[model samples]
Target: TQLLEQSPQFLSIQEGENLTVYCNSSSVFSSLQWYRQEPGEGPVLLVTVVTGGEVKKLKRLTFQFGDARKDSSLHITAAQPGDTGLYLCAGGFGSYQLTFGKGTKLSVIP
Candidate 1:
């Protein structure tokens, strides 16, 4: 079984601050995806990292895959109140199913 652990499960920051959340696992994954969810809505895919050491950026958000493919991180710059939400990392394993982390809940106070 594959399990993913996310660190600093809860985060509270003022608007315009920065934050980083992490995900780690002992199992190797074919791909990793990041998602953001708001109240009463399903998570929205933010980015997908495949190759080791790959990095993707979307506006103020950045995503990175570990060199060994066993971990990933998400960094947000100058966060806004609108950025407050639940962030999740999902790993794709051999069975083509995704094993998700507990998720990081972020609160950006304006």
Candidate 2:
């Protein structure tokens, strides 16, 4: 029942650097998810955190959900040019519908 908000609406970094993005909300959620999308393609789900304080990692990418279930974060290590994309955070409230944040656009330059 909460709306997610993402920070750093836009980001640009050089390859091999690390970066982190955040999503926050005032209302609690049952679950939260992170996704990555390219310009012409649909978003690809990266991770889902249902339990508070949960942390998931995919290679060099790490995702974490806050203990209060009202916030989340994503971190990328040694970012590469291919890592450039739109990062989205969505929260679910035990239903099929999901409330998404204003996606963070990332640009990794070589």
Q: Highest TM-score, which number? A: 1
Residue pairs of candidate 2 with colliding backbone atoms: none
After superposition, candidate 2 runs with Cα above 4 Å error: none
Angstrom error of the Cα, residue 68, model 2: value is: 0.4
Model 1 worst lDDT run, 10 consecutive residues? 92-101
TM-score for each model:
0.97, 0.96
Segments in model 1 whose C-alpha atoms lie over 4 Å from true places:
none
Predicted candidate 2 versus true structure: per-residue lDDT over 1-110, tens digit per residue = 46788999999999999999999999888899999999999999999999999999999999999999999999999999999999999998777779999899999999
Cα TM-score of candidate 2: 0.96
Full-model lDDT for every candidate = 0.95, 0.94
Tens digits of per-residue lDDT for model 1 on 3-82? 99998899999999999999999999899999999989999999988899999999999999999999999999999999
Query: Cα RMSDs of all predictions?
Result: 0.8, 1.0
Ten consecutive residues with minimal summed lDDT in candidate 2?
Answer: 93-102
Say what the RMSD of model 2 is: 1.0
